[model samples]
Target: MLSEQPYPVGTRVVVQGKRGPEVAKVRGEATVPEPQARYGAVLRAATPEDLTRWEDLHRQGEDLKWLLRARARERQLPVKLVAVEFTLDESLVTVSYSAEDRIELSSLIGELRKHTRARVNFAAIGPREQAQMIGTLGACGRENCSSTHLQDFAPVSIRMARDQQLPLNPEKLSGPCGRLLCCLQFEHTQYVDLLKDLPRKNAKVCHEGSGACGKVTKLHPLSGTVDVHTDQGMLLGIPASELKRLPDAPAPKPKRDQPEA
Candidate 1:
C-alpha cells in the first residue's frame, strides 16, 4: 500500500504562492496522498535548508492568520485560518482555512494575490485538520497521534469501545478533534489473541450450584473463571472449559487495541 512506503530524505522544494514562494522541510516521505487536495506531490525527505525555509513560511502563515481573522470579522463570517502552505516549486501558495459553511472566498483570494504577488489558493479543512495544525497532547500522555508517528488514520467505530468495555461518553472516548480516540487501534491485537482460547459469551456452561446448565455471562481469562447465569437467574463460576461453544452465540468482537499494526 502507498501508506506503507518508506520516504526518502533530503529533498527540498519551494511551494509557490500568489504572494511569494515559501519553503518547507519534508518531515518524512509521503506514503499516501494527503487527504486534502492542496498538496501537489508526495513528500520526499527534508533538508536543513528546507527546515529554515519552513520556519519563515510558518511566520508568514501566522501573519496571514491574523489578516484572515480580521477579514473574517469585517465580512461578518465565522471563519478561521488554519495554515499557509507553499508549493514545492514556489509558484503557488495555498491557504487552508475552516468555516461552518462555504463563503465567497474569491474576493479574499484575489486580495491576497494582489498583496503578495503570488497565485493564491484556498482550501477548506475540518476540525481534525485544525487539530493537526495546532497539535496537542493525547490520552497516551504524549504528542497527539496525528502530529506524531501516525502516518495514516484507520477507521474507528463504537464497536471498538464496546469490545474494550470502555465508557460510551463522547468526551471520554473522543480526541481533541472530537473524533474517536486513535489509541483504540493500539491494543486491538491483544484482545484478539486472548479471545481465541475462550468460549463465546452466550454459551451454556455446567453450573455447580443447581447441577443445571447456565448461560455464560463473562469470561475472566486471568483467573480462568467463567461466570454463568443459570435459567433461574443465579450466577455461577466455573472453569472456562466446562462451557461449550454455542452455535447461536454472537461472534466475539474484534480486538480494538494493539500497540502496532
Candidate 2:
C-alpha cells in the first residue's frame, strides 16, 4: 500500500483488507512494481481508535481460539488448533488448524457457529503452515524464514539438497516443520550453474599439471576446485580449469557365443 507521505518501516497504517479496513505494519518499501489490484492505498496512519480496535479484535480471536480448542477436544478430533483470526470488520472468523488425516469438521464447525455471529471458516493447514503460525525458532537458532518474511511457500525437494552436495541426512536437512528445509531451494540454482562447467564425480579426466589421467573424487563448485585420484596414487586438489574430461574407453565387442558342441 502506498501513501503520498512516506512512512518509515514499522509504521502502522490502515488499509483495506478483505473484510474491511485493517491495521498493518509497514515492513519495507515495495521495490518491484506489482499489479495495482494486488495492493491497496494506505488510508492513513493508525489512530488511537484504530489501535484500540486492533487490540480488542486480537483479544476476541484468542477467546474464540480457546472455544474452538475445547470443542475439538470434546469431540475427540485429531487436530492441533493453530490460530483464530477475526477480520477487522468482525464479519468473519478464520480458524486455522493442522491435522494428519482428513477430519470431519462439520460437528465442530456447527458448535463454533453458535458462539459467533460472524461467518466461521475452518482452514486445514499443512505442517509447514503450522510451524509458521507458531512462530518457532529453527535449528539455526533464528526464527523460521516462513514466519519472518516468506510470503509464499515455494516447492522444495530433496534434489535441491543433492544439487548443493549437502549430506543426505534427513535430520540435518529438515527445518522446524520436519520437512526438507525451505532454504535448500535458495542456493540450488547458483550451485547448478556452477556445476555446469565441472566434471561429475568418478568421471575420467586428465590433469594438465602432472600429465596423468585421474578419476574425479570430489567437486568443489564454490571454490572451482576438483579433487582427483591420479593413477600415480596421489590425491591432488587441482583447479577445475586445469583438468580436461577424457572420453570413456570404447567397450570391447562381446565374444560370439560358441555353438553348442
Candidate 3:
C-alpha cells in the first residue's frame, strides 16, 4: 500500500483491507516512485483509538481461537487451527485452519456463531500457507522465505532437485512446510541452461585431459562437472568443459515430458 505521507517502517496506519478499513503496520517503501496497478493508498496514520481497538480485537481473536479449538475437540474434528482474524469493526471473524482430509464445517460454523456476534467464517488453508502463517526458521537457519518477503509461493518440484543434481532424500529436500524447498526454484533456470549442452547420464564421453573414455554417471550443474565410470573400471570427476561426446555415442534422447504444475 502507498501512503500519502511518508512513514517509517513499523508505523501503524489505516488501509483498506480485504474485509474493510483496518490498521496495518508499514514494512517497507519503494526507493523509486514506481507506478503499481494494485497499490492501495493508506487512508491515514492510526490514531490512539484505532490502536486500542486493534489491540482489543487481537485479544478477542486469541480467545476466539481457543474457543474454536475446544469446540473442534469436542466434535472430534481433525482441523488444525491456523489463525482467527476479526474485522476492525468486529462485524466479521475469519477463522483459518488446515486439515489433511475434506471436512464438513457447516455444523461447526453454526455452533461457533452462537458465541460471537460477528458473522463467523471458516477458511481452509494449505500446508504451505499454514507454515507461512505460523512462521518458523527454515533449514537455512533464517526465517522461512514464505513467511518473510515472498508474497507468493512459486511452484517447486522433484524435477528441480534432479536438474540441480541434488540428492533425492525427502528430509533434505522438503522445507518446514513439508513441501519441496522454495529455494529449489531459485537457480533452476540457470542450472537448466548450463546442463543443456552437457551429455546426459549413461552417454559415452571422452575426458580430454586423460584421453579416457567413460560412461557419464552424474552431473554437477553448478560446478559444471560430470562423474564418469571409465571403461577401465575407474571413476573420475571431470569438468564438462573438458569432455566431449564420443562419435559412437547413441543419439541424445528426446526431452522428457513435464508433468502439469
For model 3, what is the alpha-carbon lDDT of residue 79? 85
Candidate 2 regions with alpha-carbon error over 4 angstroms = 1-5, 15-22, 30-44, 250-261
lDDT tens readout by residue for model 3, 92-144: 88889989889977766775677678888788988889888789899989999
Per-model TM values vs. the true structure = 0.67, 0.86, 0.78
Best by lDDT: 3
**Candidate 2: worst-modelled 10 consecutive residues by lDDT:** 31-40
Cand. 1 TM to true fold: 0.67
Query: Cα RMSD to native, each candidate?
Result: 10.4, 3.6, 6.3
Ranking by TM-score: 2, 3, 1
**Candidate with maximal TM-score:** 2
lDDT (10s digit) by residue, model 2, range 1-261: 456678889989887654457788887775424454344457799988888988898898888789878988888989988898876677888889888899877777776677778888888889889888788888889999887656568899998887788899999999988998988887889999999989999999997877888899888989998899999899999888989899988977766795543
- Model 1 residue 204 CA deviation in Å: 3.2
lDDT of 3 at 177: 87
Using lDDT as the measure, name the better of candidate 1 and candidate 2.
Answer: 2
RMSD (Cα, Å) of model 3: 6.3
lDDT preference between candidates 2 and 3, better one = 3
- Candidate 1 lDDT (Cα, whole model)? 0.66
